[model samples]
Target: MTGSTNIMIRKLIRSLEKQKKPLWKTVAEKLQTPSRKRWYINLYKIEKYTKPGDIVIVPGKVLGIGNLTHEVTVVALDFSKSAKEKILKAGGKVMSLYDFDKLDLKGKNVRLMKQ
Candidate 1:
């Protein structure tokens, strides 16, 4: 992950911690494993911690596993075929992380930084 993205993830984790939320430890653990897959990250933590209108940043890739009920806009480095289909079908949008430069993150209630 780029330096900025890493900073973002750290910030989100800290926010979760401040809220006494359950997701901080799980996400922190996932971030520690070098070989961990994107599917595991999304299935185990990211989706659980995020909500509709939120922006999710996956520094790596996205995978299809759990269902996403929220109408969030996901920005990732890459996405699996099934994930793309599911996100679109749910009226959510997906884009490359680089595309985030064009978005307004301040407009959202939550932003998930996934590595």
Candidate 2:
């Protein structure tokens, strides 16, 4: 991550700390790791693990190595261009981890998929 991204994630960590959300706090911690060591999840894995309407949070980038057949919400630190397109084409939504802070989630059907 860049210097600015590190700063931003620190702020996010503090925010999640205050909110006391264990799930998002975990995500923030994963985000703090070196970029090279972060998770790289593909569409097929997501499709296999999640059902339609599921919210999947990935701590690293989303790669477009496979196909997705269901509509799901995916939040990640980054996404490949093809990954974004594939997710959208499959009627799914993609979002950045930064954008995740402002989202109001009901906490149901939310998953953390990482290796």
User: Who wins the TM-score comparison?
Assistant: 2
Estimate the TM-score for candidate 1. 0.59
What are the runs in model 1 whose C-alpha is more than 4 Å off?
Answer: 1-40
**lDDT (Cα atoms) of all candidates against the true structure:** 0.60, 0.85
Model number with the top lDDT? 2
Worst 10 residues of 2 by lDDT: 1-10
Kindly give the stretch of ten consecutive residues in candidate 1 with the minimal lDDT sum. 35-44
lDDT of 1 by residue, 8-102 (tens): 55564454345333434444444434534532335325468877777776655778888777677887656888888888877789886544446
Report lDDT (Cα) of residue 104, candidate 2: 67
- Model 2 RMSD vs true structure: 2.6
Residue 46, model 1: Cα distance from true site in angstroms? 3.6
Candidate 2 regions with alpha-carbon error over 4 angstroms: 1-5
